[model samples]
Target: MSMDAVTLPDLSGRTAIVTGANSGLGVETTRMLAGMGARVVMAVRDVDKGREAADAVRGETEVRWLDLADLASVRAFAKEWKGDLHLLINNAGVMAIPESRTKDGFETQFGTNHLGHFALTNLLLEHVTGRVVTVSSSLHRRAPGIEFDNVDLVGRYTPYRAYNQSKLANLLFTLELQRRLADAGSPVLAVAAHPGYAATNLQSHSGSRVQRALLAVGNRVFAQNATAGALPTIYAATQDVPGAAYAGPKNMGGQRGAPALAGRSEAAWNSVAAHRLWALSEELTGVTFPLTSSTG
Candidate 1:
């Protein structure tokens, strides 16, 4: 697919929440959504930074505090939400940082990237009238499968390995969320997208200095700008795509270009694991699918 092929409709009356909306892909996604006349809530860990970013975004926009690594913050944000949400963009995430755990004692990567959005989505599901678009990555393919027995990766921890597991969890979350929504006969869609080597600050935080240095060079030389990187997300958000559809760049083996329906690893297609993950998420977060009886 080409950039020209994916056009957005007038989103004047719609409302969207883009997490990590202070910078990079999140901010770009917020800009595009607001430019199209949607009311965008810029959810971030830092309220001040979010305000600064929101100031640059033209059209209807607001900044709200949300620390995805902390479930308390996620619950607070969801509780304050009053109206229907047209687009819930799970765009906030951490990259390959050193081994750490969330305030809730979960692996930081999985906690913020997958579990946080998992809780927020379920908490806000009743109010979501349109779609849920989670930002994933091509790195998800690196995961063998979720370390169900040792989710935190414990003694076997590695930065990239944990990152991969979290990313894979993102896709599996989408898969199960869509299945539950379908079982409930809801119109809302669940989809995932990857920025595909976007030149974003996300790479700057890699645990290895050597990796970070190399990624910095790659970002300048090969990666697409944030605008192009945010396309797959924008495409997944507004397009009439199917549930669980994965979108990413269509060129250079998904490293760059326009958004298209991208393929997933065999593990990403594992429905059983998807369900198991969903159950585990609920156990960890104390949040269940809103349409519980129907989903079961």
Candidate 2:
């Protein structure tokens, strides 16, 4: 379907929180959600930038600080949130970059993309009444599987591989979250979406100047802007999609078209991997899911 802001239903009474709402797909997602009457909270690592971006959005919107690389920040955001949350869009993410560690001492991409969101989701599961939408990437297909032996990759770390692992983890996390919710007889839906080749600051972290320049040209020629790229996320959050469903662009290798159900790598659908990742996430983040009867 050609889902857009005009097609999205009025969300006047609903409340949503979007992580990394300062730029890229996060900006557009927040704009549409807020414009559609949802009380949208822009959770960002930079309060100043988040406020600046929030100014560009209409409807009831607020800015909150949330550093996905920091578990304390996630907990703080959850503690401050008082009312029921209808939507939690896990949109903020870091792409390929130099190997580093988050404040919590995990690999940066894996920490922020998978574990951080995992912790945040479990923390806020009690207040999320409607759904959770996690942003993944088509690059997930490149991942062999979850590396249970060595998550950080240690001496084997590479930019693309680490990113691929994190993206795959995003899908695995979504599938597992939905499975657990269903098993517990909960109504909350867990879905995943990928913004295919979108022109955003997501690439600003790339360490290769040559690659960045080439990508800039490619983005101008082949990539969609954040506005169009955000459709899949908007669709996943608003549509009555089934749990574990994946959404992405419906054309050009999932890059440029209306939002629709998208395919996943064989490894992505592995329930065993999903379960293992879920267990590891719980062990690492120290946050538990199915917080309550009403929110889980």
Candidate 3:
């Protein structure tokens, strides 16, 4: 199925917040939601870049500062949000990168791509009663799983492996979030999606020059443009999707096509891992999501 063939539903009176909205898939997602009459918030790390992207969009949208590398920034952004949020797209992430740490002292890729968003999502859980979209990746299948002993990737950090771990964490987070929401009978739906080799600036983080060159070539040969790549995320965020559904392009190897239900790794479906991750996430982020027994 071609991405262009899919039709988006009207989003009147809806409110959406898209992280990393300054460019690439995030910009396109914001544009589409705004075009459908949704009030969109471009949650960005840089205000200037965000304004430029927001100005390019054809519908109503606003920009807000949100640095996923900084826990304080995530908390501040959540506190400043004032109304009900129909969609929360955790779209921002770091790709392959050299070993580094966020201001919050987490490894760069895992921190920004997983833990930071985890904190942000929990902090804003009160406002997001409709849907939450976590952008994962096909690369999630590369890593063994979450390294519970060394989440920060302390002494053994290979760029791709670290990124793979983060993406796996994303899927784990989504599934666990859905379970908790269901258990509590909350109105919020948790889903996961991937762009499936979208041509974006995310590769700039690669630590190796050779890896970056390889990525560039791969993108040129196979990657879809940002707009086409954003469909799955939009589908997860806006469609009448079932809880815990995973969306991605329905194409060869799940790349460059319309969004549809996609497959997840066996480990991603582990309830025990999800539960453990959830508990750890709550402890690490210092944010407790209220779960009631009535719905479980």
Best by lDDT: 1
Better of 1 and 3 by TM-score: 1
- Give the clash total for candidate 1: 0
Give the alpha carbon lDDT tens digit for every residue of 1-296 in model 2. Answer: 23544367788999999999999999999988887889999999999999999888877899999999999998998888899999999999999999999999999999999999998898888788999999999999999899988898899899889999999999999999998788777789999999888999998889999988988998999999998899899989888789999999999989997889999999999999999999888888898885434333
Each prediction's whole-model lDDT (CA)? 0.94, 0.91, 0.88
- Which pairs of residues clash in candidate 3, taking residues 3 or more apart in a chain or in different chains? none
Clashing residue pairs in candidate 1, if any?
Answer: none
Tens-digit lDDT track of model 1 for 87-192: 9999999998999999999999999999999999999999999999999999999998999999999998898899999999999999999998999989899999
Winning candidate number (TM-score): 1
Better of 2 and 3 by lDDT: 2
Candidate 1, after superposition: displacement of residue 115 in Å? 0.6
Higher-TM-score candidate of 1 and 2 = 1
Worst 10 residues of 2 by lDDT: 1-10
Model 3, range 1-296, lDDT digits (tens) per residue? 22366667778888999999999889988988888889899999999999999999988899999999998999899889898999999999988888889997888889899888899888888788689999999989887778888888778888888899999999999999998888777989999999998999888668688888998998899899898889899888877789999999989889878888999898888888888887887777777775565644
Candidate 1 has a TM-score of 0.97
Rank ordering of all candidates by lDDT, starting from the highest: 1, 2, 3
* Model 1 CA lDDT for position 97: 93
Worst 10-residue lDDT window, candidate 1: 1-10
